[model samples]
Target: MSKLIIPLAIGAALLGAPAIPLPSGAGGGALQARELPAYLQCVPYAREVSGVRIFGDAHTWWSQASSRYERGNRPRVGAVMAFRPHRKMKLGHVAAVSKVIDSRTVLLDHANWSPINGRRGQIERDVKAIDVSPGNDWSEVRVWYAPLQALGKTRWPVHGFIYGDGAPAARPRVVSPPTHVAVTRAPSRQFASAFDAIRGGASPAGYRQAKPLPPQRGYRQAKPLVPQQQESQRKSQGQRTGAQARDPIAQVLARYD
Candidate 1:
């Protein structure tokens, strides 16, 4: 068999032993490739053992069209693929199935993978692949087996593969709320209130009121004389002068008048 399949055979043998429970957070929704056990609470351990850079959460692994896992989705050869988020764990998780040694065993590559409080980056650990049922239900599954040397320097209870507890029927898909839409509505109200405050001190349209001009200087009124009245005054003055001319003394008196 291929080198990849050998580890799987070893993992299958351990399946008969007592099962080890996965960390509480795994198993809720569809798994994605990048979302393997790394990048979550398990990241610190995965980096130490795998000697690879792991960043971002599992959501990065999703390919919108195909529900099935693909290498194009993750790019890395041995990278684990995670499923979509679920109600139980907001982030979904999965592992990269590296090698299939036999019907009962497969080589699993996963980071930050271990029992509760276990070390990370346990590379290419041997896991048993039991075909308990033909369908894709999570419950009809077998446990994975990890060797002591593969676990690096860290030592804990040496247990065999632990079968996963089957998930509930009718698994629910997790949907994140639309945050961008909510923010758009809030800015409209806040803008209107700001405009109203600015208008209060000036015009309702938010323009400064022009100051009233200083009171006009007092107006001087002159007597109004008709054109005919002005002409009559000139004739009367000429007649008086003519009568004064007839009498020398009267003329002098009239001139004085």
Candidate 2:
């Protein structure tokens, strides 16, 4: 009766558990996991092509470049155009400027932007991007969509352009040496005694110059502590002792002794 109750509880728990959707090609129980196709994201692709080293989400690149890279609203070749997060684009997007057509239009090279052949993460090069802002400040833009074969209707907001030209290299961190290192009690006592001797105009006769340490070298065969003759004699004595212990006649003699 108790065993039946345990089985029933397990069955109820499993039935209530939610079903999780696995990615395509991730086969059933016994099959080994397969590698998914490479998906190139905008951030890494822009950094690789434009030479911008800024990290984190695409939207954050504008603020992060304030100290490291130069930024402006006007687009130029090799500059990354940062987009502000709008309705569906919660993380925003970035693209490298491939060519500057004029003040209002430019060519872009980016990835994972538009769905091509019904698949996302497709790379698009030299696609059109136009400044549609009322003041022509490049604050809003319309980018090319592969499916539509024209500029997308949505006016994606722009944070501006992050220029990689002459971007300052990250300064190496400078860790200042510790000002107050603790002195052990034994060393302090020794120093105090030496100071007292010097103050009293008395020479410290007990003090001697420390010997220099041995020079460091790569591994070498170590010299035996005892002389060769002594080591050989010790080995001979050990062998005789081991032989006697193993002999039954010697064992009986040893017990009597």
Candidate 3:
């Protein structure tokens, strides 16, 4: 019986080149690449670290947290802003309050916003965002874009803010003392414009007609608001607090009040 001996060889040359051992999951290619940074998405990440108890996408947070947490349209540091759907964001977006610069400007920390390294689901920290709403209501805003390093043009509408158990920054807001003036009309000082007091320090009964007050940054009024919008606000307020629903943001506006 003649037995033929067969030689078995296993080496880097088997793959046509020196086989550089790779991690098990590394995909085979002429150019090996490392895995991208693994970062969390917006909604889940916000919920996880926000200390707020709410669920669903960013758009649903405000309505869901209305009863349990302090919800309002004003931005306070540490609140989660629930963006509304618009031309750009169809599923909506959520960002945590990192800093309140002023009444109409804030810095937000969010994930999956700016595309980095040509990848989605990235994190943007301490990005500047500004309120562009006509009412200065914190409803419409523009967020900073990392690639451009500038504020984006896409206007984003927001449902409002959800406040949790978080401390605010050292931002000092001059919340004009709650005025006994008609609730319909914000205090003259609170709504000062570019014009000044008439001839002297006397403001005409009609501020619009009087010399306007020098315009102050982060200070604006929801003037020229249509009757329909006013009526809608009132009606909506009535629905939220029941008999006391006449004021919806009582808990929220308390800071400013």
Candidate 4:
């Protein structure tokens, strides 16, 4: 069983939002209130995608004395958690949540979450969120290299799963394929090359100009030709010659005889 950390001071520091009072007589062994700011900052993204509003301290398990795992056991949709080693820096870590899409698999979000200059605030993304876990919360979550920046922008499909008893078993139906309707798509190698060329500012005169088109006529009269001219042209034709050579009267006489 993973040990849970429930720090009390962090719960006291929450400003506008009222703290969630833990259930009385709820097996109070140890409680470590989680920090509000970092967890609260992730709430908007969670709410937008998962439809659940996270309030109060984010609950996590202490896998070891120095290390804490934010998401474990009771995995819920849109819940974000951190994974820190037992005796390491605060920011060199991974963050993700349980995506309840189905009964079989779940999605994860993690990135190059190393601390910049030993500060808790500095973090960046070499981040990807594409891990799948079985339908049990206790099962270890597998991290995927695929990261999702926007909810619907990948060629691959997005899905999630739930674990444990009485959990819903239906898979999330895909409403539509991921679309790119943004003014500019995410930067690619071609865009980078074009940007580099423009920055170099080497203008050549090899550019071509467009050509002009001819004016159009509103209407035109059909040309009239003699019927004899058309007949004369077909006079030497093989099909017409073969048809003319067949004797219709001889065929009728042969049939009668």
Candidate 5:
């Protein structure tokens, strides 16, 4: 739910050849996306480690970087993929390319798409994203989910990849976008108790962590009762005894039947 406000650094955008090269034999691996190690979140990680200067909704990245940075329709390692708006993704999404798994699949690092510890804003590194588009132009794609440990069903839009190595130009031409769009990973609680219910055999955390019961009265460790509680118990017992004394038939039934 954050907006991307990027600085148009003139001399840093990727123009022609990329500065960071792709790994050898990258595209030959499995087609599915994978999850990265644990971390704080995407926004800071993208800005701190990946060196993405832009700040806004992930979808607005293309427009914000269009002026000072270069944009493209391909996927490359260290390049940021700026996604266009789509269903529920009104603002869009951005991810750093970690590896190229053939022309149809690529591994990435991003945040907030996967729920971690009842949180939505945590970071997910080295996750897989597949280009679902049949045109092979890198238009439509499906990203990996962290909590579910699988590829999500949502087909996201792509503006293109924005490499950090591009040379900076003049001041960026600011293209203001609409309101921020929120992205949801799975459903509320990921469709289970804590989203952990379905993932962990449906044993709810609440049930598993329930408080222990009090000891019985005959037990040595039975909790001591307060004066008020003792008084109430005595009054109830006294009433029962008085009723029994008043009825000989009740006493006979108790002694025999």
Candidate 6:
């Protein structure tokens, strides 16, 4: 009977028949493999943990938060650290700040950064990330690697941080009032001198010259000579000069006359 049963079981296994019950441990590995957690990406994990609500690729998070969320270079807890595409990381990376150890060090919770069990898209919790930028502005960083069990040697570029709050409102611009000046026009006066008037241009029709100032105290007023009086005085002076030339006694004779 035992020999008959053994032959029957062998025939069942060869023909691919399931007539016999298998052990409880049989195919356990395949079942566990099928039940493994699905691979996760950095973007969704960052959004979920940080509550930044950003979408699309990791590099675009900084720009997308410009108007919607507050962003800066300083790292804060619950903020998403946006990584710029560098080296072989073509699509870039994003991670949530679990803790800020100091000015230059931080702990990050992200996915797909380091592979586990010979597969990618694994989640890493509270991994160390150090700021390597010269200015200490968090512009560059080096993240912990699972394979090396240490911080990676590569200096990855970063795009700053995106906070979980809405952006502040813009301030209104102030304008100054226009200035006013007081201009006084000088009173119009007649030309002070004829030469000045001529240089300025020919006087307009009906233009009159300025009046002279009245004589002041202690000043003598002289009478102007007429044209005829001036000619008579010149003739008399010339006759006296001719008489002197004709006679040597003309000086005495002029005094007697």
Give the winner by lDDT. 2
- Residue-level lDDT of model 6, residues 1-257, one tens digit each, is 33445655665555433353445555642221112234677888888888888898887888888888887888878888899999788888999999886666789999999998888888999998887776778898878899988878788999988889654322223255668856586435553454466788866446776789999999989888899999999999999888677552333223322
Count of steric clashes across candidates, in order: 15, 0, 6, 12, 24, 0
lDDT of 1 by residue, 35-134 (tens): 1232234333333333334444544433321233222321122434344454443544345445444332335555434543364444444443332223
Q: What would you estimate as the lDDT of candidate 4?
A: 0.38
lDDT (Cα, tens digit) per residue for candidate 3, span 1-257: 11211111132223212224346545433223222334456887677657787877777777777678877778877789889877767778889988887776788989889998888787788888877776768888878887887877677888878888633323338467765856685557634542344545666564544467786889886578699999999988877768454433332233222
Stretches of candidate 6 off by over 4 Å are 1-38, 167-257
Local error of candidate 2 at residue 31 (angstroms): 14
- Estimate the TM-score of every prediction: 0.26, 0.51, 0.50, 0.23, 0.47, 0.50
Q: Whole-model Cα lDDT per candidate?
A: 0.39, 0.77, 0.69, 0.38, 0.65, 0.75
Tens-digit per-residue lDDT, 149-186, candidate 4: 22222223122221222243333453565677666767
Q: By TM-score, is 2 or 5 better?
A: 2
lDDT (tens digit, per residue) of candidate 2 on 128-207: 88877866678998888888887787889999888899542222233567999796655577678888887897755587
Give stretches of model 2 more than 4 Å off. Answer: 1-38, 167-257
User: Each candidate: RMSD to true structure?
Assistant: 38.7, 28.4, 17.1, 27.7, 27.8, 38.8
Off by over 4 Å in 5: 1-41, 167-257
Q: Sort all candidates by lDDT, best to worst.
A: 2, 6, 3, 5, 1, 4
- Give the TM-score (vs. native) of candidate 3: 0.50
Off by over 4 Å in 1: 1-56, 64-81, 84-89, 116-124, 131-133, 136-142, 145-257
Off by over 4 Å in 3: 1-39, 166-257
How do the residues 1-257 of candidate 5 rate in per-residue lDDT, one tens digit apiece?
11211211212232211123235544453222223333343454565555879876576667788776766777777788877878776766677888775555678888766877886667777887776675656787777876677777677878778878784312223356778878666566535566666477666655565578887887778589999999999999999989878764344234322
Candidate 6 has what TM-score? Answer: 0.50
Pairs that clash in candidate 3: 193-213, 195-211, 195-212, 195-213, 196-211, 196-212
